[model samples]
Target: MLPQAAQLLNKIIKLDFQPDIVTYGAIFKGLCRIGDNASALTLLTKMHSAAHCKPNLVIYNTIIDSLCKDSLLQQAMDLFSAIKTDGIQPDVVTYNTLIRGFYNSGCREEAKGVLTEMLKSNITPDVTTFSILVDMFCKDGNVKEAQATLQLMTRKGVTPNIFTYNALLDGYCLRGQMEDAEKLLDIMTQNGCEPNVVMALLEDMEDKGIRPDIVTYNILMDSLCEAGQLEDAAKFFSDLVLKGLQPSLKTYNILVKGFCKKGLMNEADDVLRKMEKDGCLSEDIFLVMTFPRHYTTAIL
Candidate 1:
């Protein structure tokens, strides 16, 4: 469809009807969307040579983004310089695209340098900018730099979002900084970020051979329960036992309370019976026994 549109534009141009910048921009975007950067660049050149229509910042940004995504970093950089030479100031999007490109290409220093140049140009880095930097640093195992970037982000008044915390949490977990990860998790909860947002981190932990302790399981179960995923929580409990990890009293309490809260008396009773079988049914069960009548019926 985009190619057909481009052909239509060519026919219009042949008849001396020059398409406007908006028309050219749409075609450029479509071409870039399909990774046809070659055609997009050709159209950009033709647009530049046309007497009435010229490429704007948006068109240039689109092409630059495509080039970067295709890992044509040098071409993207040349176009970055070209945009400035054409008297067009590169916006935050332009810088961000290049920065992400450099990072994806393993040019960490170049990525950082782009951020520096962006600051020098007085383009205020948004949360996305900081989040990208934090994610890059964390993936590179430079959590210290990630931490510094986070601090700078806050100092610049860009509040950290879930993505920012998740990246740092992943970095800490990757480095076996479980204590720090737990502390960060606590901070996330304190800051009103949902624990379920970091639930995927459990897979990362397993992949990295980081044995999740009882506390970690408790957090996972609690998050699952809070999200109303009682079945998943129960499966995780079974997994815990299969993995030879003893379910603590708190673990049983989380599942029992989660089931009872959802009025799942049978499921809650099953967990209680299992708890008794494991010799984990103690007085501490009352702590999570919110439904006294149901608890009395189950225990009896």
Candidate 2:
């Protein structure tokens, strides 16, 4: 597909066929996946004007997804407005994509408004939609709202996906509600939706009948760190090494920040040394290491 995407575009242009909606949808998705939104939108506009290729819900969703990939949230919103003005009623996908975009931009308030709009239009929120909202609430540190949205979805018979569970669990863990987090983790497995920070980690671990990945450790590591349980975080990092899973930059950053927060300069230095030794230090983590602060720094 990589070697041929440009070739396909060339063919479309040579034919002057104005790329039908199907062609537009295909190219738009490919462009978005590759983070090429400008060309995708241009093709979208061309498709919209073509009498032979009237845009539908899918085409609209495709464009929105492209805008989102480029982090163009406001542009996506404007496009949605244009979609409405074009007499095309936004469907579930339209609202869902914008909900996700709003969340991505840390605009949870806007996301909430979108949710309200969704309900007003009677477009039933699906599991994926709920999952995004749950993630947004958790990341925003609005655990109460996260829990409420979770319960709301449950009562509406929209079961939470694995992402939903992970987001909720993360919220509880951040707030030092380990017991509650564990309960939800158990229920998630009972419901047969496995957690995957990234899909490869799951399939890789499953193949060896072992569970040693950066994300699993990070979940516990983040929770423990937030709880001021550095012993647990340090131990978890070591356990990951023993299991032959190298710590990702995220894992290293978590430990470094955890130690710094505790004013344990010695421990922080040791962890930073380990990160350098393991080649796990990222630019962002390296920046934090350079700016290590004492406990009193927080008062300023």
Q: After superposition, which runs of candidate 1 have C-alpha atoms over 4 Å from their true positions? A: 1-4, 154-163, 186-196, 207-211, 286-291, 294-300
Off by over 4 Å in 2: 1-19, 189-300
User: Which candidate number has the best TM-score?
Assistant: 1
lDDT tens digits by residue: candidate 1, 235-272: 88988889999999889888887887787878887888
Quality of model 2 by C-alpha lDDT: 0.73
TM-score of each: 0.83, 0.59
Report per-prediction Cα RMSD to one decimal.
3.7, 16.3
Top candidate (lDDT): 1
Deviation from native of the Cα of residue 80 in model 1, angstroms: 1.4
lDDT of 2 by residue, 1-300 (tens): 832875676576678756655665676778777877777677667666666667777877887877876679988998899888889889888898888887787787888899899999889999999888888878878988989999999999997766787678667766766566655654554465433332333334346454434656676576667667788678767877887887888788788778777778789789888888877777666665676663326522
Error of 1 at 188 (Å): 4.2
